[model samples]
Target: MKIENAVIITNKTRLESLIERFNTKAQAKFYIEHSGGNFSDYEQEHFVFKTSLSAVVEKLSVHFKCKVIDRSYLPNYIFTEKDLPVVLGQDGLVANTAKYVNGLPIFAINPDDSRYDGILLPHNINNFEDQITRIVHDRFVYDDITMAKATLNDGQTLLAFNDFFIGPASHISARYNIKIGNENENQSSSGIIVSTGAGSTGWLSSVCNQVSRMSETETEIDMDWDEDQLFFVVREPFESKHSKANIVSGYIDDAHPLIVESFMPQKGVIFSDGIEKDYLNFNSGAIVKIGLADSKAHIIV
Candidate 1:
């Protein structure tokens, strides 16, 4: 592979070491994404580290004949849809991968082994300098994994590489009406969780227990009800007689409708890919459509 311009991204703490190493071996341009506190918070505790990182970037730019840009410049510079190879810090790997970038292989360097889990990383920062040449020049395999797409009542659509959860934001239980295709299913649970294949190992496993019970009686179940498509699990619903949470598991068949309604006072929150996206009101008949996402994450092995 021919790499003319190389962008090196790193956290604030590891910027100096990475810059020094890059300057000694290669002459490619470098860029850093400092992992300081959010830029908006002026009184954040990590201001000192942010300032120190800025100073390091300036010094390295003059020494290595490269330009140093902040994390804010990432959208404008790093993700330009070009076919260039991008080396990212561990944090950058997770953040960017969630955004769904096509055609570019993002190589992540794990800075600390004990601090974080480097499940998606190709190499550790300790030995990355020595193996950098081999990785950039060789052929690597990446897995194309699908994501889940959800459309809210407001016509806003979002994609999740993991799972989509709809539940109460507080201690109160959430009540919602569920419909499969044109048939309105009985409402009896707290909330519902919908997950894709990649998310099956996460919360889906626990939720599957509730739905799996139904499969025992029916031998000739629909193939779409399998683990690959969508899994629906109900949470604890409000009951006047009994104050306990109950969960039920089921899958949405092909062309079948799946919908939920909230019956509690508290607001319902929808989490996409484990991150909170929007707050849903129960007053109106808000419909949330869930399905498979178009893009996939290319995981380099």
Candidate 2:
């Protein structure tokens, strides 16, 4: 497909966020310095990010129409097949932008390599324009990353490029009934995390770390990024007279999905990719099915 436009996705810099909170840059600097923090670090990070973003805009503008959008607008942004997504941020930004891109080829550029561990970013400002040129010539290579999806009985759906957290909104035991294949049980625990292969090293890895530390044994759960299967773990499942912990961790495939029914009267939620604000209410009477999404994130590697 001929690319007609490039949508550059970005996020507010830390300095910008501090300014927004304190109402001015000088006040933000005063607040940070007063708290024994280095205000110049923020300034330097912001400067590097802006410089990288400017370079990205300049490069893409030469070959295609370019428009920049903040990360906050991703949920409602309308993307087309002919529109190439050029993300300029950390690895998490690529995960955040993947859900809304509808499988468009994403060319992720690491804006500041010194500040970010860009696991998903394969290009840097030094060599990104060459890849863009290849993309314009229809010779760019990409990887189709699998993603997880949670669908409610009410028809509401949420996609996760990394993982999904299902539990109470607040810090409390999540009450729910979980079913996979034939087994079913009522459980009270911290929450449940369903992770795609692309996210096995993310939040899911921390959970694995905890298990390995507690059991004194190494646990390996990583998988291929394009694998169709997904993994889920029940965090801190508690066994009681009314709740059982037998149904804990398991794998979900296309033939079998994980079904959860909320028993919490209020504040139960299902959020993806660590964005708590973007979530679906999982209160009483809500049933959600977690499985592999039909779409994938086509990332330029």
Candidate 3:
């Protein structure tokens, strides 16, 4: 559907955060300076982002009716049928915005090319006018980025752009019964990270790097963004009398996916893309079904 209204998604910069904490820009600068922090650095970054945002918004307003929303408002904002989402921030912002967009084709716009590598963000302020033109004419092409999903036993499901973390909310051992194919185990680990091709490099790469450095096991973690299957990693599974660590990491294909039953009496959580605030409860009786979501993110590459 071609949307006439564009929704520009963005997040607060460091300066906004500082002002939120101290109630004013002057107080924020005062606090930072008194604490020996580089206030000028914050000012420069904020200026760049704000200036870039103004330009992007101005360009977008000339083409379509634009509605700018903070990244935090995505969860509650009801997206209309004619809403066009233009994400303007870091890769994390795109990933964070992707799950809530309901499969709207995203125009990933990077406000500042120098600070962000634009992995998820392919377009910048210098060239987004063309992308918008293409989008307006329904001539834009998009890639179907695979997404990970976690369905709770109570029928609640959560979507992830990059990955999903199933474990304790705090720094504690997460006890769960993991099932895959004909194998199952009662394991005690930090948690499990389930990722799609879109999120292979985000947290999964870090886990792979740590494994590559610390161990001799050939725990290869590689994924294409549009792969049908999902990859899962059980973080630091410990071997004990009842807990096992054999089925540590593998692919979660159609036939074989990860099923984790929470054994933690409390504090068990299921969150995605590193957003700990937005999560579903997974207590002792919860069963989280991990697999690919029915809908993929249509990202304009």
Top candidate, metric TM-score: 2
TM-score attained by model 3: 0.97
**Per-residue lDDT tens digits of candidate 3, residues 66-127?**
88899989999987769888898999998988888888888898888988899999898788
Per-model tally of clashing residue pairs: 10, 0, 1
Better of 1 and 2 by lDDT: 2
Judge candidate 1 at residue 78 and give its lDDT.
42
lDDT tens digits, residues 1-301, model 2?
6899999999999999999999999999999999999999999999999999999999899999999999999989999888999999999999999999998989999998888988999998788988987898999899999999999999999999999999999998999999999999999999999999999998999999999999999987978999999999999999999999998898999889999999999999999999998899999999999999998998998
Better structure of 1 and 3 per TM-score: 3
The order of the candidates by TM-score, greatest first, is: 2, 3, 1
Candidate 3 local distance difference test against the native: 0.89
lDDT of each: 0.51, 0.95, 0.89
Q: Candidate 1's residue-wise lDDT over 1-301, tens digit each?
A: 3444444454433434444556731221222224443333322323444543354334334323334334434435544333333333444344445444453555555545445566656655455444445544655656555566666677766665556777676666666666656555445455677765656666666654555676654222222212335666666555554333333555553455356555555576776655553334443356677665555655544
Model 3: lowest-lDDT 10 consecutive positions: 216-225
Off by over 4 Å in 2: none
Candidate 2 is scored at a TM of 0.99
Ranking by lDDT: 2, 3, 1
